[model samples]
Target chain A: MSLDKATVAHVAKLARIRVEESDLEPMAAELNNIMTWIEQLNEVDTDGVQPMTSVVESVLRQRSDDITDGGYADKVTQNAPASEASYFVVPKVVE
Target chain B: MNDFASRIIQGATGDWEMVIGLEVHAQVISNAKLFSGAATAFGAEPNSQVSLVDAAMPGMLPVINEKCVEQAVRTGLGLKARINTFSVFDRKNYFYPDLPQGYQISQYLQPVVGEGIITIDLPDGESREIGITRLHLEQDAGKSLHDQDPNSTYIDLNRSGVALMEIVSEPDMRSPEEAGAYLRKLRTILRYLGTCDGNMEEGSMRADVNVSVRRPGEEFGTRCEIKNVNSIRFVQQAIVYEAQRQVDILEEGGSIDQETRLFDANTGVTRSMRSKEEAHDYRYFPDPDLLPLTFTQEWVDSLMDTLPELPDAKKQRFIDDLGLPAYDAGVLVAEKETADFYEQVAEGRDAKIAANWVMGEFFSALNASSGDITQPPVSAGNLGGLIDLITDGTISGRIAKQVFEAMVESGKDAGTIVEEKGLKQVSDTGAIEAQVDEILAANGDKVEEYRGGKDKLFGFFVGQVMKATQGKANPKVVNEILRKKLDG
Candidate 1:
């Protein structure tokens, strides 16, 4: 897929990111090149191949479903930029 | 046609049918989070149960909790679904304050469990099947407590990364009552399997209700999803409101928009949260940090063997083997503890009588006193003993109610309470004869009036005799003796 300045700005807005007007063209052009490079794999001709989802051949490792850790609320929230009443506080989010 | 399926709205032009489906998120019954070893207990202080992995610290990888997978499989089997031997996890990218990570790890495109069937028992002695779309395992986001401050919101990540079984149902329900029944039946099965607590008020179980309205036999209308309805009653209300809203829009020649809505518990209305076009595009990709989950057929079978007799099977047994009426069987099997209590009381006794006492007196007593079955003030054995008293004519049915109240008050067995209080039925003819003679002598005017054809005085005579004996008189014996004396 190709990208344009307006589409790039729209995507950024949907992601809740503010994009500068001067940077949209460069970002869109860069994104288009990446997309085109990735699209080159369409030329390969294998029809019956299964998609490889992971590199590891092992089964998913599991742990017993027991409460082996926690009770460190102080440590967990210590790095929050703003915290109060044992909770991370942020500017009001409406819904 | 079923009556519940017939409940419809007479719109500006004609009748409309509501199509409803539910996506229920039931928290898995585990002590730890899904991918971390942190405690998953509810109502803890904010962030108290967070581990580094749940907090999304740098360089921390996820390890699946094996018991959670077992729970999901058992749930699938209980719902009569197909369990996949191979499944993968995909990350759904989004941004929210409660979500520590920018993306949520969910199973998309290929969920672990496939199609299943949930048979909902309609009130008209008919059944309807709501198809199960799919079930997937996903981690929960934390809570955003907005009421904590006016200018800021507080976040509690204690629930973050907790394992949940997201069960999606097909759009098969036609009315609000059907949706309610569907939720109740689903919850009952999950509770019986010990996979979920099914406590909606505690937020352990929640539903996302999708509602759409259309003219009968027309194409499906645009649907909206109501998010996080915590109670079954609220789910019912939300469906009704959202469906009516859609119908109103359609009747005005306005098209419905697919969107997300919120059910207002206070106003009993639904308000738009966002339109579908403005919704976040969740770019999903398989997480490279974890491997694909694979389990053998043997493992799934073993879990199947562990499932207790589910609600439908138990209900059938109660009806076929125990001869309980369909409605009574349904009521008794709504909860496992209640079903077990009914079985214990019904063992070798008159099953119909057992059903009556459990569904009638016992249930009302529990409701009146705000009691539960786990530690019932009146034990099942004692309840059975009370029923035995009435069955064997040791006490009349009227007298047994008083004895039952005494048992609840004193926690005494039926026989103990009868003997201690001298409340046994006075079946001895000689004893009843004496009380009958005294009542005949004292109520001379009434006896004359009765002989003068005041036929209703017979009940008065019986009442007096019963009152003299403290309601312990065998009703049949009292009627016979009083009839012989009063008629004379």
Candidate 2:
């Protein structure tokens, strides 16, 4: 799909990213180049060629459909940036 | 056949056909992160496992892990996909705080593996083949902490630079079920190969759902990509919402636009996140810093030699060799650990009976304890011992349940538990006959009813006999002696 500069700017806003005015031109040019490359795929005849899904051709591997831990509170909280007792601490949202 | 394609086309007024493909990112199960030697254990202290490399310290260069590559190849072979003799990694330019590296090391044009197929089993015992577009090796981005603070964001680098196999599927699925089945089948294969842990909850495996809608007979519709749908339930919900969104657009005489979208589980809707970029968006030139990866055929062959019996083959063995039902076989071979445990318990025993016990009482015990078969309190050997006791008439099934519980609690052999508890089945005919005589003598009217050809009273007699034995009577022997005494 072709991406325009206006669309890119809007996307950047949605992503909460700040793109400089100077960088916009370069970004647009790069995005256009990518679209052109992907356009090359249109030249190929994929009519009968099945799309590949996996890298291997093996049977499925499964584990018994059993439930396990949503437990391990300490391990879950071990890496929290801020913690109070066993729970993770975050900034209060409400007044 | 009115398959998913036909139904989708029909729903679109026979105008166009919807095409779909998937890109699944499965985290590699390794002792440490791909680049750093920091422990990759799940549920760890958030940033405790982070190293300087993961934190993207200045002047730190990413070093490739050989084990990750081998696992990627093993996965590629499992998929019947081509292992690119040479592949290169490129930096995917993206700005997210979670990505400490600024740019993610991912494959753009040259991925480690290419072109594979996954055959998914449909509900009606039919199978459909989905094509694998590519499987590339990439590093994971860290996480952004948005809920922690309103004005500030935090970064957890524990996940950064962790290895991932970005498996892209062809837009071959037409319905939500097929998409789900495809993901499940792929996950099953990866788990069996021991390449990926396939833990969606741990963020070990995730799906980026690509959905588009078109008229029944028309070309592919504009596709929208949904990012980071971590569970199968969410994957299905995401696709349904995305497809409806596309259909709504077409119905309003507007064209569907190709873009990246986010699924809000709370609202059950997809909102546009970004315009889907073509390949050039990331400027996907091969990385100048890293060399191309190459592997020898001998190494690939050696890995293949060590591959355990996968789900399909194992399922077939259970059916042909063990005479188990197809459903039972399918369930047993879904996971390697479960299959191995079953084999140990089923050896030298009736396969059907073994299956019943494993799937029934054993599964319930595990469930009750909130454990997996891997951590079962009762070992396969102990379970087998319990099954043997039942088959040899040492204990009736009713008595065996009691013994099995004791075994699970104490980790004792079945024989020792039975002996200690005095829980042996009463199979002696003389003893059983004496008990039956006492019961019949006490209940004269019921005994007269049995002699008078009221056959219904026979069950009452049997119940009396079992009660006399304290529920320890061998059911078969009790029935046999009760019939003889009544008939005489």
Candidate 3:
């Protein structure tokens, strides 16, 4: 699948990234190239083969429902650019 | 089928029927977050319950919580839904202040549970089966506090990564009442399973309502979703408002735009959400951090064995085994705590009597005190003891009510309250005969009237006898003595 500049711009917007308008065409071309390279795998006849979710054949590990972590609110928000009362602060999102 | 009057809006041009579906997000009742070992308790300090994994720290991985998966499967079993043996979690990519992970771990194509059905009882005493499209496990986002600051929002990651079961329903509900009943029934089942608390007010359970208007028997209309209706009543209200809004638009010859809307509780109206929220391209893909979840049918069967008798079965038992009226059984079994309390009271006692006492005075007292059946004013054994007093002729029903009121005022048992207040029924034949004799002697004219075809005055005589004994007289004994003296 080839990527268009508009599609690249939309993806960037969805990711909350501020992609410059001038760079959109180059980014789209790069993404298209990557998609083309990945599309090469589609040429192989792998019909009836089960899709694999992981490289390793292991089930997801599950932990019992127990509160073994937390209570370190200070360390959790310590690296935040803006925080107040252990809450990370961001611009208001009303919607 | 009989009582369902289509919840239709009579537009100026034509009639419009509402079609509603609800996606309820019930927080799993586990001790920890979905993937992190953080406390999942509500109302904690802003971020006191946040773990590094919950806050999305770099390189922190998520491990599945076993109890949450079990809960989802148990809920699926309760709903009589197909529990997919293999399911995969997907990343629902989005950006929001409350979502620290940039994407939510959810199930999209392969949900934990497949299609199921829940039976909803309407106010008209008719029941309908609403189809459950799917139920899936997902991580909840954090709490966002926008009004805490003038220009910024505060984010608490305590709720982030918390396990949630999003139970989606088919567009089977045709009325707002049906939607309300659907939520109530679903909540009851969840509470019964102990999978979720189903407390909508506490944010343990919430609903996203889908509403559309269509011509009777016509194709479905464009549906809009009203997000985060936290209460069942609000869900009903939102459906009504949203459906009417759609009908109004259609009636005006305008097409409806499918979008996300918000319900304003104060105004009882629904308005479109921001335009940006409408174009949600989640770009969902299987989460590579976690492998596919697979379990054997033996495991599912074991979980089913652990399932408690759900609301429907309990209600049926109350009806079939206990001979309770359907209404009373429905009322009692609506909440798991109430049903359990009723069962405790009814144990080894007359089921109908116990049911009456529970549904009548017990529930009344509970509501008056704004208390729930979980922590009722009277214990189950104590309530059973109270009912036993009436059954064993120890106290008349009238006096038992007095004893119950006293028990409520003072935290004493029925027997002790009966002893202190002298509220025991006077079943002694000698004492009742004397009271009857005296009443007859004083009210000679009424006694004659009673003997001379005025049988209604018999109640007056009984009342006098009871009053003379301070309402402690056994009603049957009083009636027998009065009948022997006056009628004979």
Which of the numbered candidates is closest to the native, going by highest TM-score?
Answer: 3
Worst 10 residues of 3 chain B by lDDT: B1-10
lDDT by residue (B1-488, candidate 3, tens digit) is 22234588889998888888889999999999889999998999988998899989999999999999999999999999999999999999987778888899999999999999999988778999999999999999999988899999998989999999999999999988888889999999998999999999989999999998999999999999999999988887788778878887888899999888999999989998876572489989998899998999999999999999999999999999999988999999998889989999999999999999998888889988867777798889999999988899999899889899988889799999999888888899998888888988999998777778988998898888888999988889888877777757
Give the per-residue lDDT of model 1 (tens digit) for B133-182.
99999999999998989999999999999999999999999998899899
Residue by residue across B330-378, what tens digits does model 2's lDDT show? 7788778889999999999999999999998898899888568889889
> Between which residue pairs do clashes occur in model 3?
none
Pairs that collide, model 1: none
Which segments of candidate 1 are over 4 A away from where they belong? Answer: A14-18, B1-6, B275-277, B437-460, B480-488
Q: How far off is residue A66 in model 3, in Å?
A: 2.5
Number of clashes in every candidate structure? 0, 34, 0
Alpha-carbon shift of residue B61 in model 2 (angstroms): 3.5
In order, the candidates keep a fraction of the true contacts of 0.88, 0.00, 0.89
Model 1's A-chain: what TM-score? 0.87
lDDT of each: 0.90, 0.78, 0.90
TM-score of each: 0.94, 0.78, 0.95
Q: What does the lDDT read for residue B272 in candidate 1?
A: 84
When only chain A is evaluated, what TM-score does every model earn?
Answer: 0.87, 0.67, 0.88
Native-to-model Cα distance after best TM-score fit, residue B353 in candidate 2, in Å: 1.3
DockQ of 1: 0.74
Q: Tell me candidate 2's interface RMSD.
A: 12.0
Alpha-carbon RMSD to native, per candidate: 2.7, 8.9, 2.4
